[model samples]
Target: MISDAPFASPDSEPTIRVQDKTLLGFRRSIDNIDAALIHILAERFRITKAVGEYKARTDLPPADPKREEEQITRLRQLAAESDLDPEFGEKFLRFVIDEVIRHHETARQSE
Candidate 1:
């Protein structure tokens, strides 16, 4: 059974009722989704790393403002359609874009 209190004191041990299995089920689903997100991010970074290598070899700019803006626009629209916050989607995409650009710049310097 989950605690009636929404939050436990930081120093207190969490109270759980073993008879209440619903919370466990929900937590398992959350864990699975978290794992999937990690795998997806890993794959995305692998592809972006290859793109960075290609851009480095071809002397292309590490950062593309036009492309980034287009992606943010698209992501925001998609997030809105999915009932998510557009601003959050844009922020998340911007963070990833910044990291990718950093990797590209590092690759370029090493070339």
Candidate 2:
């Protein structure tokens, strides 16, 4: 079960009710990591939003397939070096890239 307490502040550890101490510890770690990932993704989108606006203003195409492919290749190699699943990394990146393209398209339509 999850605690009622807010997990907003990193300094304040989130509480969870679990019978196993080890499992509770793991859960808390995962929660913190998940929160951090959300923050990271938010930042990424903020930058991408700016890029979308720039692309729209410059009348540039929303999706660049060559750049996307190059990024996938580079990230897959990095994922392999980090002992993470390259395919998963590529999928995650692709998802983000697709969303960015959608935002860019919207921006273009508004222009």
Candidate 3:
């Protein structure tokens, strides 16, 4: 079953527009953006899933904080180089990493 819009963040709410005769009205907008995010998130998971599968296949443990730290540092540096706010990017990436870890755990449990 479809769940609540996962894209609804504390800092932002998903905007739904009632611009047509659709029964969903604004729900369509919410679904559209939320659906797109799901696709993007799923594509990201494809890569991570491959990583997880390889790890499982090779019997490697999950949750590497050192690797995550290295990644945050590298991405933050890259973000600065790209003219983005390194601090902001770092914090955001860290949050995403945590989310990813949670997703990874859930996926592992399901398997």
**Backbone N/Cα/C clashes per model:** 1, 0, 0
| Order of candidate numbers by lDDT, starting with the best | 2, 1, 3
> In candidate 2, what residue range of length 10 has the lowest lDDT sum?
1-10
What's model 2's overall lDDT? Answer: 0.91
Local distance difference test scores for all models: 0.90, 0.91, 0.75
lDDT of 2 at 16: 60
Which order, best to worst by TM-score? Answer: 1, 2, 3
Q: All candidates' TM-scores? A: 0.83, 0.82, 0.54
Clashes of 3: 0
Worst 10 residues of 1 by lDDT: 1-10
Weakest ten-residue segment in model 3 by summed lDDT:
1-10
Error of 1 at 13 (Å): 11
Query: Which numbered prediction scores highest in lDDT against the true structure?
Result: 2
TM-score of 2: 0.82
Q: Cα deviation of 71 in candidate 2 (Å)?
A: 0.8
Runs of candidate 1 exceeding 4 Å displacement: 1-19
Q: After TM-score superposition, what is the CA distance of residue 28 in candidate 2 from its true location, in Å?
A: 1.1
Score candidate 1 by lDDT.
Answer: 0.90
Which regions of candidate 3 are displaced past 4 Å? 1-41
